[model samples]
Target: MTGYTRASALGPITEFVETRGGSIERIFRRVDLPLALLDNPDLPLPLREQFKVLREAGREIGDPFFGAALGRVVSMKKLSAFGAWVSGAPTLAGAIDRSGRGLNRFLQTATVLRFQVSEAKARWSIEFLDPGKDGRFQNELLGVSYLIDGVRHYAGSGWTPTLIRSTCVGAEQAAALENVFQAPVLHDAPVSAVEFDTALLSATGPERKQPDFGAEPPIPPPVGLREEVAMLSTIALLEGSPRIDWVARKLDMSRRSLQRALDREGCSFSTVLEGLLKDRAVALLLAQKRSLTDIALHLGYSDSAHFSRAFRRWTGMPPSRYRS
Candidate 1:
């Protein structure tokens, strides 16, 4: 099942569309979203539906850069406690780390936010975990925009990213994005990201009073058995290869019962583990600095050759070739 995003995360949607002379009501109806969600900030909207709303609204407004434009005006405050928590971090790097961890906890699910540091640059990326058929071009741009905005909060209003990487923008759309981001953007990339110098990571924000967020919201529930299993397997992968028996034990159930539960959901532990491994492998490869042996062991492979074999089976290419 696809995960849910808090409606507040999309608080700017209605106004953003209407200001551009688009009927958000019609677009909402077309996507089966309730108009009431605009007023109900606490409600959870399906992540898939949220992606559709943005895509359709962009088309309806005849603004190919609609998502990127809307992202420019989006306030992090709309993210509720999640926003406050991230903003309160002392350093820019801490804020980025908190945003990534808090995303699945307080704001949304079925997404991955990564902050990776290399020699002199840091890559902050956002990826939708659900690989459904919905058009995510707009959502992807919006996500990258948010990452850039977060950096600006600490780097100051005049800061521009070193580079922006995107998976969706074509030649025609690149200029519009360049104007918005004030940075060179590379399209058709592996993932959407904001790449900047490591120096900005330690930038500090002014000391100011933070708002009373009351209490943090409860962590969002797992979307389904598959997602639940996937989450556990991900953590287990760090320790080594994830075993079904270990996962079942963590869930407080027998191995056979857990297998049956997954069977009813039309998936198995092996499939879930494979998917997690593949995602991790791809992400590590994108870093472009990790060696084959390090990447292999990190993903729980016994050796580089074993991982190379698996990579060939999964992508019809070896890891070295894929990384290149």
Candidate 2:
């Protein structure tokens, strides 16, 4: 369910460049990115490169406010629009559902926020969903950390996740997860998720009114749900038990078309599949309660030995060692 694409972050990013009299080419060379990527907005680049590019550009102009302002353009701005949409919902949950639909209208880069609630607990997972299996764990974790930090920037300083999860493991990965969530992060969960007081999600926060973007040009129109769902489902497919062919069919596309859609969105099916296996293998291994052979079967690995090799490739440690 994931493809890497530029997914325009609005003219704010472009404006950031303009403000400094800098061109996008400057960022390409400065961040070691491919300039050809600019032609396709759906292609996702490095999150660290993204932040660094913006952070450095802002710093070069000596405006910390630019980073905060860019945040406003991308996600914080949408919270307000969503708040307006839900302003009259009878309950907080109604507002969350309403707001959830507009997620792409705000954050278009490597991210997903899934929301679910029941009588007992409310679950919302803010995932920095990566498309390929080709990112550093540290870089990916840092993106997640920045997202939470940015949300806290708009939400509150005290915000935290109930359960922190990662697609990687080992003492190093575990420590990064802990630092990001600022809580006891469990290493072996099926996904990166957070449980919270659903009530808080309902509360009237800063998201209630659209903020002016100063001088940034208008953003491109929002992409469709089919496109978003396809992208999401593909990323999820990569990170976990890759289902959602059913979901894609609903979009009136064959599995192959759906994959092409994903590729145009900057991802490939095979990459996501391997990422799912890597994530599952790591999580299963770290939990340690499962036997190696059982873990292999669970991950759809041919057998224990194959899973062991994959585990070693991803974590530089054997599943047996992780279990120990």
Task: State TM-scores per candidate.
Answer: 0.66, 0.40
| Alpha-carbon runs more than 4 Å astray in model 1 | 207-216, 223-324
216-323 in candidate 2: lDDT tens per residue? 222233255444553444333332344657445434568888777767767765555666577667776777687888878766667889888988887788878776
Error of 2 at 121 (Å): 2.6
Clashing pairs in 1: none
Relative to the true structure, candidate 2 reaches a TM of 0.40
What's every prediction's RMSD, in angstroms?
19.0, 20.7
